[model samples]
Target: MSLESHRAACAALTLLVACGPAMADLQVAVGATSESTVALKVEVDRIVPLASLHPRLELRLATGLLLLSSEEEDGNAAWLLSPALRWTFSGERGAFLEAGIGGALFLETRVDSRELSTAFQFEDRLALGLPWASGELSLALTHYSNAGIKRPNDGLETLTLGYRYPL
Candidate 1:
């Protein structure tokens, strides 16, 4: 990645994290982006009222890095920025299911010689979470793709486990 891209990513992440509500939850997530890829993500989300969609809806901002680790693919990575809306069901205690969708921008479009066509993509996620007084534990399945906006819109999938702590 170019120095400019790194600076841009840092600036965007700062903007996302700095603008969140003072008492928002901070989460750190780790898991596989694919059979050959691993991802580590961090997000800050705040409860926002959107009763029509669900009682426990949140506005979330996230950023993560995907690590590619195969022969020549080693040392390859992408920085991701996503702004999403999440709706939780079954209330906020015990077991809960959350669904979310948003747009993402990747710092790199090609990894391991696989062309993702463009740097812009869409992300969809479904997650199961267990909330505690102090924090939450979650497992999420997420997909990222260009939605045919460009040719060869090869997509990526990630399965991640996360921990969220109030901040």
Candidate 2:
């Protein structure tokens, strides 16, 4: 009915699809990144079942929160939501390649000033895992920009390393 309602419905549908009958794996990761500022993040992703028609290897969903600190100002924070598709190659070890698009919301706060803005993000990720140990290591690259919303369009790029435990 409304924009917020639409977004909520979309999110729910995405989650439902991510957890369908073909789901096989679930993982949670914690990591940090180097970018405009340093940030720490926690993320979760699940493997989606592939169908003959769809032919995808996996589906993923993740959410992260990042904080950037400044010596001259208070700080800034961002919330990120992403959904991705991945292809896995199984070997003595397992490896995967992934790509996704998502949105981010940033809130900036200084001693007495505050601002809010939004951006769209494109991301690429790679990972290797050990099935016996239930451990995985991953690398990600992300790019962010305003999607022509007339808001602050300052762009940001980040590189991250992550370790995940399957649960």
Candidate 3:
């Protein structure tokens, strides 16, 4: 990653954390990309119930960091912050599905041979979650891309298993 890009991403992440709402959940996840690169994530979900829109629907502001392991040691990482809407099907059971679209800043534009073309990318995610007594267990698939705004937008995808604990 270029020094300027790294600083900008870090600043954005810090702003996300510092200005966040009071109630939130912290989640940690581990997985691998389709190409087998190791991936890890740390995220915070700021819960906001939207009863007016729908009883079962809610809005969440998600902020996080994603780290990817490159096959040939080229840098790999992305920082994301976005808003998501979640719909809970099982009221008391706490089972839900959510999807979100947000912006991401990559640590490196090129991971191995995949040329992302820009440090700024888009983050899209779909997740299924179930909450137990202690916390929540979730399975999520997240994608990062430049949305054809530039050339060589070879996107990145990862499937992850995550654990969320309220803080």
Best model number under TM-score: 3
| Best by the lDDT measure | 3
lDDT of 2 by residue, 1-167 (tens): 33553455456445634654343334433443333355444454555556454553666776654444445454455556777776667643467777777776655322112222343333334444333456666677766556545554445555666665554
Candidate 3, 94-138: lDDT as tens digits: 799989999988777876767789999898999999996688888
User: Which pairs clash in the backbone of model 2?
Assistant: none
lDDT of 3: 0.80
lDDT of 3 at 6: 60
Select the stronger candidate by TM-score from 2 and 3. 3
Model 3 bad stretches (over 4 Å): 1-23
Model 3 residue 41 CA deviation in Å: 0.6
The CA lDDT at 86 in model 1 is 60
Q: Which ten residues in a row have the lowest lDDT in candidate 1?
A: 67-76
Using lDDT as the yardstick, the better of models 1 and 2 is 1
The number of clashing residue pairs in each candidate reads 0, 0, 0
